[model samples]
Target: MLKGKPKYKAIRILEGCGFHAQMGLEVLEQRSLINTSPNGYLDMHDHIEEMGRNIACRLHPNEPNKRRRLCDKEEIEEVLVNDLGTKATRIMNLKNPSIHPATIIEKLRKMKALELLSVYDADRVSQNWVFDEDVQYFPDTLRSLHWTGYPASSLPKTFQANDLVNLEMTRSCISQLWEDGDRKVE
Candidate 1:
């Protein structure tokens, strides 16, 4: 009922509402798909139903009961097979709080959706995982990253390696090096 340029405020409120509604739609769509009759007995309807329940729980308005459910192997397989398609393989690479790489890869390969490559690291879960010199399939975006736990092998390969040459080889090395440089100037 307020007046004078409430367009921005109205837009914000409407956008927020739309976002939640969109999420609910996705949940409903997934639910409908899960309820659809499977092609065969091995169609994993039980697993799909569980995943749909989890999704519904997450999108529920009850904040106290909205705790995100960690997906298991069966749930991951069902979602990958029935929901995400090729994007499922990419998402499989993500570090799930509760799921296994073998489980994901097994289903993906069985579905002929992804090729299991021995070249890739299976246990690579953390965002801080190290890369070796032989790593060939790394993303180009990773090259310019400034993460705290930079790989020791890659350190010498970066522009910042020159800083190591300035380091002194002793206890209180940094302070001692500064003092030494000051004395040399005087």
Candidate 2:
């Protein structure tokens, strides 16, 4: 599970994967593990938050490629630069990435087991970060994705959505998901 409180979409995916987030929330509420913040976000005690981070870090202390999630910019950049991602990485949520979008997509080919990937503006306002080139590939195991300000006119011809359950591209420059090919519809 992720360190911070999961959002609505994440809860839905957790439910799809057989997790009862509502039930867990109830338990947390009963135990005072969380408090409703002024802005409505769940706030966890600092110690609890630290414990969660520690648990995630202890999973594979020496190897980031074995971690299930990569949320840090530097670690993600290092992994991308070194091509160290493995099948163990299931979720990658990047916000305002400084690295080239091309490099990110190019290295994603190695994450064969990636299921949830999001590269969006954290503030939900910036429109500066845009993918200039066509994404040539996406893992066949993807279940959810979010890419804001996608500048390409269409997704890659090689890309397929056979296993995609959720796809959100808000304020993107995309004109179509894919081009009309030399084929017929059923």
Give all TM-scores, in the order shown.
0.19, 0.74
Candidate 1 off by > 4 Å: 1-49, 52-88, 93-130, 136-186
What lDDT tens digits, residue by residue, belong to model 2 across residues 1-186?
Answer: 333434555456666545696777668878998755554456677899777667876888878788988777778788988999899998887887777666787788899989888886544333444454455567767777778755455565566666676778787656677756522112
Ten residues in sequence with the least summed lDDT for candidate 2: 177-186
Off by over 4 Å in 2: 1-8, 34-50, 121-135, 181-186
- State each model's CA lDDT, in order: 0.28, 0.70
- Residue-by-residue lDDT tens digits, candidate 1, 10-128: 23332332335334434644765422123211122466656665674565324311223313444444553443333222112222223333333223332222211111222332333
Cα-based lDDT at residue 169, candidate 1: 18
Candidate 1, 151: how far from true, in Å?
7.1
